[model samples]
Target: MITNMRKPTFIVKQSLKIFCLLTGFAVMTWSFSFTKYIRGQFVNLNVLPERLKEYMYFMGRRLNGAYLSSLNKADNHDIPIIFIITPTYYRLVQKAELTRMANTLRLVKQLHWIIVEDFEVINLKTQEFFQSTGVSFTYFAQSKRSETNNHHRGADQRNAALDWIMVNHNPSMPAVIYFADDDNAYSLEIFQQMRYTKKLSMWPVGLSGGRTYETPILKDGKVIKFLAWKAEKRKFPIDMAGFALNANVLWTYKPMRFSTDADPGMLETKLLERCCTWAEIEPLADNCTKILVWHTRTEKPKVRMFDNVLEV
Candidate 1:
């Protein structure tokens, strides 16, 4: 009886020892792999105090903006830069939305992101987030003013971005400008199609206008008419996600802007009228048959209880 009891106890002890050893090995392996990742992020760091550098690196472990910095430094004069203008407002999902957009934009080369906030003053938290995104970006806030009932939402913010381009952008530099909404889904292929837009380029937008998609009907590689809900009513009936404009167009037509007083759904037409006509519109993405962009809107989060607890 005593021998039998001892044998069972010894087996239990051996099993426990094996389990602990396996657990410890896993933890050590994970630690080493994580350390390598952190060290890799700081490989290109050249000039900063050790303390500050450490703080910055640890604060944003995903420092992958090296590609944009290098591209900006390169003397590639022929590569047209795609300037993406995003007008954003404060909301529970704002950070999450921008983070998603940044991840996509980071993969794109020669892209400059211009984000305009609909706030009276610049938000520091947002600035830090943008810096960590690893994409070339310009950040600013919209001017404060009372809005009339007829003024379309986000018109001021979009106009502010265009204003920045007018004052700051070099017209001689080959570039294309796109009005990218924060909540939309964009494919890198769309960026490629619009990169060398001579005047104005357009493609199909998925899930827009309460339909599957909206696009400009093309005939012989030219935009003949829009295949949208109110195509016959407006000059440019497609959603904002469907088009890209040449940066030179904005510079050439200095006063062009989205009309604040334009009725709902008329903003696109107001701006496009100043830029190009139907005959001048260029079709892209296999002559407008491809759905490269989506007008996706995030469902509002129920954060009443969580709002005061922490930032979402």
Candidate 2:
């Protein structure tokens, strides 16, 4: 009886050990699978820091002469174009402003201008100005501004321009697009510095009057962070005029449009949230260490109007 009892006890002990081992193995396998799933989710979301690191690694590895040579040929055949989207209202004061922008473009090569009027039709002076420049341009009017509930005409007009570009242009064409307000000052070197933009390019704008006059956070010739009061809550903080976008990214994410409903300082956050994070934005114009553009607001000119006479 004693021998038989010992034999049964040993068998039970061995069985328990085997069960624990099997359970441990299953738990480890499940943990590994869960980790992989989380990583996949991050990639799909295009979260800034991780995505930017991955892109940099890819660019570094592919930066060889053979790769560059092939890319050069391909780029020549399908050259990356630039489109400057400017939204304007019917203010007659903008004539000088538009002329300044036009003169700046003369220093930039191979750029397309998308000038949208926040009115029912383009006025004669605006039409004549564009025609006289002989620069590549597309003119359109968002006539429904007065009828719409939206008051942020700038954001709406920019979105319209983006929609127009996606609808009319080839998706594969290399292009860089930027929103240039009518009165802002642009530097010549800004365009040259943004030439090799892969995803998004950024530069510093002067006189923003935040913690930093410029928002570019640079370490080792790369943009690591953006310090802006506007995007303090968001993952990255940047001004609308501070960055440029690649056309492919825009086309790939077609319906990603700007929101006029975003509260005063939230427009940049809302737009960036739809696509990439701070990490995915590439730095250009030498990490914006040198001031290239100024975020100068138009000074309200003092003028006197008496019956039929106007004095400035």
Candidate 3:
């Protein structure tokens, strides 16, 4: 019985070896053909069918860690850094809104979040919350000019963030600047597109200016005009979330800062005019047809009920 079992085990081992050897030989043969094709050699293309080429490409991407190692890499000096400026104010759902935003921003590559709170001081609780989220961030406080003023109070905080950037980041460094509001919902694709902004990049914004979406009218990869509800009234009728700037633009055009003194709902236009003209705006998101960001607002949560029940 022992002799019979040994014979079967040995046969099985030999069979496995033969199978592996045949698979290796087939892969090597195909790899040689693929290499030749890659080098522009028009060899017998029948060796690599469409389906086999697709399979090998997919497997090659996986094995080479293209999708697995997107954020952290051994060498990424060529990648441009993205500076995201978020102006936040205390609210019933402030923490919840920030937590949701951070979850999305964490997936972005080469990002630095600059969150400026509209408060007199940066509270310890908020500091601890930002740290716990694990998103690389710089938290600071800049009090609103008036306690009761509701006319774009975030303008001051945004300017503060811009000042911080100007002082901290070098103008020679390759970087992109985006004003990402905490209440807005963002798609990671926008980050990818904005990373390559040479001067000014604009895309569509969903649910902006009392419309389904607002975008720049592109003609031959250039912005001809804006397709917004208030396009006629405002010089640059793009939403704050719809545009991004190359860091060098801000460095060179030092006057490009947000101001509450601008006409109502014209803060975006005010800052944009100092940076670029309509012709200079580069239309992104497939020529401004796709919306990669949305002006979403979270409802005020009823946390007062939790006051008498349990700590929330």
Cα lDDT, all candidates = 0.77, 0.67, 0.77
Candidate 3 Cα lDDT to native: 0.77
- Model 1 spans > 4 angstroms off: 1-76, 143-149, 307-309
lDDT of 1 by residue, 124-188 (tens): 66778888877888887775446545657778888878877777667888888898999999898
Model 3: per-residue Cα lDDT at residue 272? 85
Q: Candidate 2 clashing pairs?
A: 80-174
Can you write out model 2's per-residue Cα lDDT over 170-286, one digit (the tens) per residue? 876677888888788888888776756787778777777454365778787666766666544655466777888887777667577887767667777777677776677787766
Go through the candidates in order and give the clash count of each.
Answer: 1, 1, 0
Q: Which stretches in model 2 have alpha-carbon errors above 4 Å?
A: 1-79, 144-150, 209-212, 306-312
- Lowest lDDT block of 10, candidate 2: 62-71
- For model 3, the stretches where C-alpha displacement exceeds 4 angstroms are 1-75, 146-150, 303-312
- The Cα RMSD of model 2 versus the native structure comes to 23.8
Model 1 RMSD in Å is: 16.4
Best-matching candidate per lDDT: 1
The TM-score between candidate 1 and the true structure equals: 0.74
lDDT of 2: 0.67
Better by TM-score, candidate 3 or 2: 3
